[model samples]
Target: MILLGERQILKVVRFATIGAYLGDEDDQVLLPKKYVPSTLCIDDEIDVFIYRDSKDRLVATTEKPKLTLGTIALLKVSQITDIGAFMDWGLEKDLLLPFREQTIKVEEGNEYMVGLYIDKSDRLCATMHTYEILSGESPYDVDDMVEGMIYSIKKDVGIFVAVDRRYHGMLPISEALRIYKRGDMIKARVVEKDEEGKLKLSLRLKPLEQIDKDSYTILKEIEKQGGFLALNDSSEPDEIRKQLSMSKKSFKKGLGRLLREEKVELKEDGISLKKL
Candidate 1:
């Protein structure tokens, strides 16, 4: 069977003005004349990538696409049409990313990570829903800093990442102070190896800024408890974990920042939100 969106070697069964017809007796796709090699003859085998043309006809090419089925790549948008956005994927026909499959409002000339798939009409298309499509086997350990692209956003879940543009990784909502948008470049560290082997990433990698992340968590918790947390730096480690879900050392560091910033005040009993 001919596999769309993948490279395969096929036989040159016949010749035509348009190009060579490649495949066995069951199926054939035209390898356009411009891409045809010199001294090529009937029954010669050539490696080719298969995709449909603008006319929706299956065609073969010697050129490789930046992405293929079940995998992802960062592609640049060429233009935006009413139907979808077109991207340059190193093919004669610009790849189509239909609006419905987009995770965000794509702007012309912006790059987005997308995966290839065959649509319902049997046409090749690109999609931004790549959370499950990314490869999970990554060479990273806990606290190893890595850079990636934010490929998808799962509301109330987390930020889906493509580390080094291939491995599956994610930043949980609790690990962030703000929501990261799709197509955003991410520089973070691996915090845990998830049960499924995917990387659980965290942005609190730098020692200098690590307090910021913990401090934000404390501020939110204090505000959630009506501007007061009975747990303070003097509190026991178990109490800090029970009340704030953080270590006592982290609590002290974050509390110190809040005190320095005057967002909260240390009191005789506990920490209180400073009045505006």
Candidate 2:
């Protein structure tokens, strides 16, 4: 059977004006002349990725698309037509992004994260609505370091992530140390599994590692501010958060490390670089 949206090693059975008809016994797909290997001949096998063309006809190409069936990726909008937008998926035929599949208003020359799916018409198309298509279960376990793309951010909720572009994961606001926007690929550690089996993620480094990083940051800030900064353990939580983008608890922990190492001297009003 011919597999659409997949690469298959098909045998060349016959020739045509446009290309060579490649298949086994029961099925054949056209391998366009441009994609036909110069040394290819009848009964010889060649690898080709198959998909429907603009006319919805089954066609084969030597070029591989960035995304395939049941896969999600960040694709660029190549053009916009009356029917829908076309995404350049590194294939001869731009993948279709129909109006109904668009989650937001898309325009030409911008990139959008989308998923590929076969529609009721048995044609492959791209859709911006990917959350529903992402799987909730994953093979990853707690504390496993994983990477994912940020899909959506919600106020007071968290940033929704599509792990491996398939599994569902989220990085909560409390764990976010820096600002992250949609479409950014981030590396995070799995903190726990949610009720639905989706992953709860943490972008912060491991405790000891974070302390080391924070200590370095505090020392650098103090030096940058003329060898002293008006920030100390007694500083307001909001002020610490505003300056460091970290919780007061974390700032205190980092400050303690710096003080213990004699790297900085803490005073009533601020901290200063220790003179060696």
Candidate 3:
């Protein structure tokens, strides 16, 4: 069946003006021009990412992918141009890594492990900077630890993380329990590898207990001020960050424990110490 908004392995049924068409039970699908590789041929068993075009039309692409729609893989750069660099992702066409998305200018033949995703423009793209994704790698199962560094953050998706600099991970807004800025050095645990091989990391691991403790101190002050501390979850996440210097999740976790233990009470007005 022709599944929409999903990637599927389909056999090329025939060639079309735009590119090859993969045969679905009902109709032939277009694989588009820029996405086709020069070597693709009819009857070739190929993996195609199927998604709706601007007009909500079903479309496919053979561009180098960072990871299959729900799978992850390391890819290598094939060439770089003024507009962007291309990576040989085992597809008909090299995947584009636009210059603007680059953390650092890439040289031809250079390799970077990047998370692959279809951008707003419905194009395949990559990035070397993935910090938030890596942060969610924590709370991992026994013996599920991996190492990588913070690469970048820009106020979206919490943080883009890189695992071992080869795997892409995401620390979604809900999971980022601490305040993390770009380039902050962090060690995270791999909690789970999604079907796409994207990792979930955690910075709230036992190893960071010391930092968590420090965060607790700040929470104490917020509590003393009453359950309605001036600290807004939306305040300058960085300025107020100077006091706790931890992710919002971590800060809240520490505070939540204190409240649960009756050590403090948070009110709509402010946070306050629980009376003995």
Candidate 1 collision pairs: none
lDDT of each: 0.86, 0.87, 0.62
Ordered list by TM-score, greatest first: 2, 1, 3
Model 1: weakest 10-residue lDDT segment is 174-183
lDDT of 2 by residue, 26-116 (tens): 8999998988888999999988888988788999999988887656788999999999999999987898899999978998999998988
Q: How accurate is candidate 3 locally (lDDT)?
A: 0.62
Q: What is the lDDT of residue 85 in candidate 3?
A: 89
Indicate which candidate wins on lDDT.
2
Q: Estimate the TM-score for candidate 2.
A: 0.77
What is the TM-score of each predicted model, taking all chains together? 0.56, 0.77, 0.37
| RMSD (Å) per prediction | 11.1, 4.0, 14.9
Worst 10 residues of 3 by lDDT: 131-140
* Residue 267, model 1: Cα distance from true site in angstroms: 43
Off by over 4 Å in 1: 135-276
Error of 3 at 16 (Å): 8.5
Highest TM-score against the true fold, candidate: 2
From the highest lDDT down, the ranking of the candidates is 2, 1, 3
Question: What is the alpha-carbon lDDT for the whole of candidate 2?
Answer: 0.87
Writing each residue's lDDT as its tens digit, candidate 1 over 1-276 gives 678989999999999999999998888889999889998999999999999988889999999998887778889999999999999999989999999999899999989888888899989999988775777678888889999888777778888888876788888876654446776788999989876679989876566677888899899998999999887767988788777767787789998899999999988889899999
Tens-digit lDDT track for model 3 on 92-183?
A: 55667888778777778866656565678666566554332233333335336666545556576656655554456556565554666644
